[model samples]
Every structure is written in structure tokens, then in C-alpha cells.
Target: MSTQKPIRKAVFPVAGLGTRFLPATKAIPKELLPIVDRPLIQYAVDEAREAGIEQMIFVTGRGKTAIVEHFDIAYELETTMEERGKDLAVLDPTRATPGDIITVRQQVPLGLGHAIWCARAIVGDEPFAIMLPDELMVGEPGCMKQMVDAYEAVGGNLISVLEVPHDEVSSYGVIDPGEADGALTEVRGLVEKPPADEAPSNKIISGRYILQPEVMRTLETQGKGAGGEIQLTDAMARMIGTQPFHAVTFAGNRYDCGSKTGFVEATLALALERADMGSEIREIAQRLLRD
Candidate 1:
């Protein structure tokens, strides 16, 4: 039985008007926020590339033109660095060539489902990966790659799931398991941001998804489930009986960069991992705590 289905395209929804970050987000896209030296979205794209994704489709919104430009080649900057014999460390990550990237504008202020729907004409019909830039997963093999391997073994719709606190289950899409292996669970049902007491299980959706093309059709008419938006969970829930849906409970640390605290924590955590800046970052945090 061949499980692999030539999953090449990936859809990244970056159109969210990050109101939570406020004034800072006014000028900058939340996806562009720095995680160490690399912007958050770059990590998402890098993860997709590592997982054998061929085309990068960024679903962007107004005021997100810069997002398109960031992935483009900066000729002047590259030329200057080449002439000066300076190591273009910055250009290393920015080296994703022109054709590999594509952008579609989500003119309306719709939810994640709508943002994905915008890429339908381009995506056509294919099993694609969806990675939210805000969810930064730090792991040995990268989160998406782990999911891709699992998808090969399991051969169905795969979602990256992790156990969060029971109290915090309401903050995420909860998954109910029918059968469980070491790191994979046969998904019984999906609860979108249920109340703490009503949540089916502690396993919550973390942002990495290896979804089937049929999901796009569901999203097209998903209407609105949670928060009055066409929830992706609502669509996924519908596919339970027809297709094999499983949650891959892989081990990794995920940070919610959408929130201020999460963003700051990610910055400090990554900074502490760097050889040049770790000492300075640790000392500053220690001094701040001491004072």
C-alpha cells in the first residue's frame, strides 16, 4: 500500500491582522517578527522545504505586500555583499529563489479557512501542508518532517497534536482519540475550542497539518463553527468517517508567538541558544530579576 501522494504544495495563512500585538503590529506583520535572526514565517517555510514541499503559497492580506518582498531576492544587498567580500549571512535564509514562492491576496478579512480558500485556484487539488507561522515548534527533525514521516506510515489526514493542560484545552482545537499507539492516535472527533470541562481530550491542534484536498471543498461550504469563522476543525471533523484522520503526538516544544508573553519567551529562549548572545541574554534576564 503506497501511502505517499506527492504532497508538494503548502499553504501558509499570513493574512491575520495581528491586533493582539497592537502598535508594534501596526507597522510590521506578526509573521515578520524576529525569532532570533530569522523572521517567524521563514522558519515555517524552512520547515516546509525540509519536509519536501515544492511550492510555497503564502495567503496574504492588505498591508502584507512586504511579506512578498521579503521572500524575493535583494539584488542591491547581494551585490554590495559580494563586492565587499562580506559573508552574506542574512542572504543565506533569503536565498529562496523567485519561482519557488507564490502569493495570493486575501482581499477580505476572513478567517484561516477563507485565507486557505484564496489559494484554491493555485493549489488546484493536492494533499498539501498548512503551517501557521505563529506556532514555533523547536525540535530535532522539525515538526512538519515528523508529521510527513508519520503520514507516510499511516496514510491519511495527519495533524500535529500535543497535550496541553486540561484547563488550557479551551484555547485550542481538542482531539478525541479512538485508538492510540506510541505517538499516533486514531482521531475519533475534533472539538473546536470547547470549554475546559467539555473538551473531549487534552490533545490540542498545534498548527502543523497534512490535510487532504477534500478539505478544501468542506471549507468552501463550512459556514462558521467557532468564533463565527469557517473553522478548519469543523471541516476536519466532517471527514472523520470517510477518511483516516489521526493526530501525531510528537514530542516538541511549541511557542505561541501570537501572544506578547509567548513572543518574548521565544525571543529569549532562542537568544539563550545562541553562542554569541546567550551569555548577554542570560545576564540581562538575571539582572532584571535581581533588581
Candidate 2:
């Protein structure tokens, strides 16, 4: 067994107002939005579970109850499905054991740093993961699993990064790199939303993160950065030299479900990958393109 602390918990910050989706999101939590058939949050949970995460910590706000209930046992629904001879196995990935899942209210719309800091008590002193449900990553081993395997080898904070176009660097947290080996890049520094001309590298931090408990301590005193909010990048940047901070360049397809375009693209991509819907979806795509 590795002597490094085992990562058993994952923190999910799902308290966003999701204004981008407008009236549809007015009554529904954006995280509950269905992509292909499964809700966005379900995919994130599935990735966490695949990576051996045993406990889920959701930092929620008001009007986010649907997210909680989605993971709970739906007695009536299950009974109906069973009576109708429907497969219960399909729901397995969506359900969680009673004590395995927990939620804390963010209460206020602070930045991502404050949202994560809200879960400090539940996360305690162990190394934990931070997964944004908005970023749906599809891979053979799943994104988190790949990071977990890398974490076991390096034993420090890990964040998923992807190389975006240089002009788009201003839209993301760009990394100042050092040494590199394979998929791992030494994150010497981080610049959040820097102008394209000033960005150190085109690699931007993606939504998946494997962070240490010490980062919570750094977030405690982290001031507002970038968009006048306590940005998680600021706190994480402070930990770069103090700990083994590295970025894992994900080798998979990452769909940003946080935006309208990305959401539609993810739906189509996933639908095309499904055995039940692939043929029909492909045909529809071909027909639409020819029109």
C-alpha cells in the first residue's frame, strides 16, 4: 500500500445561480439538466465513484434540493419500474448509500474558493478531490481515475489542464510550467484570466482537481482576485512551491456543459456514443447537415 494519504472524499461546488440557462434554470437547478438522459451531476458522481471516492460533499444553496433528491432512493419510482419489469441496474450509478453522501449550504454566492472552503469541516485533513459537474469528461478510465493513478505516484496536489488556443488564454487560468514528464507538467505558477499576450502558456486549468487539505488553510486568508471574488486559482497558486503542484493534461474529450454550446455538443456526442441511440443520432446528424 502507498504511504501517501488516501483520497476518500470529493467536494462538489454546485451552488451557482446558473443564470446562463435563464428561465429554464429559474425552476430547475442547472446541475440537474439532462444530457442525453443522465443529469450533469450524475456524470460527475460517476467519475468520482470510478476513482474510488467513498464520500460525496455537495456545497449547495437554496433551490438546489433536486440535486440532493436525485441521489436518494426514489421508492415510488423504483417500485413502478420494478412492477413494469424495468431494469433497476440502470439506476445504480445514480443512487448513493445513505451515509455516503452529504451536503452543506454555501448560503452566499462567494467565489469558488469560498464555496470549497465551506466544505472544510467535512473534508478535514485528508487529501480530497474537487469536481465541477459542468465539465463532462469522457475517457476510457474516466478523468478522475487517471488523476488518481497519477496522484498515487506523485503524492501532491493535481489539477486537470488542457491546451487551448492562445487567444483564449484570457478566459482561463493559464499555467507557468517548469519540468515535465509524460502527461504531468510542473505547475510553477498560475495566472488567472491573463491577457493573451501576457499568458505564460496556453494550457488552462480544467474543472477536475485533486487537492490537499492544506489548500483549505490557504483559502482561509485568500483575498478576492480576478473578478473581485475569492478565486480558487489564487489560493491554489499560493500552494505551488510549498507542495508538489502539477497539472495533468487530460487525454479525453471534455465538454463544458456550463455553456449552451458546450451543453448541446455534449448531448450530441454522448448520444452518438450510446449503443441504444447511436445509429439514430448519427442519422439525424447527417440529415441535419445535408439540410
TM-score of each: 0.96, 0.97
Q: What's the distance in Å from true for residue 188, model 1?
A: 0.8
Please give, for residues 52-118, the per-residue lDDT of candidate 1 as tens digits: 8888999988888888788878889889989999987766766777678899998887678888888
Tens-place lDDT per residue, model 2, 1-291, is 677798899999999999999988999999999998899999999999999999999999999999999999999999999999999998898788888889999988889999999999999999999999999999979999999999999999999999999999998888999899999999999987899999999999999999999999999988888668888988988898899998999999999999999999999999999999899999999999999
Badly placed stretches (over 4 Å) of model 1 are 1-3
Candidate 2 local accuracy as lDDT? 0.93
Relative to the unseen true structure, what is the C-alpha lDDT of residue 143 in candidate 2, on a scale of 0 to 100?
93
Judging by lDDT against the true structure, name the best candidate. Answer: 2
Q: CA shift at 144, candidate 2, in angstroms?
A: 0.6
**What is the Å distance of residue 126 in model 2 from its true position?**
0.5
Could you give me the TM-score of model 1 versus the true structure? 0.96
lDDT of 1: 0.87
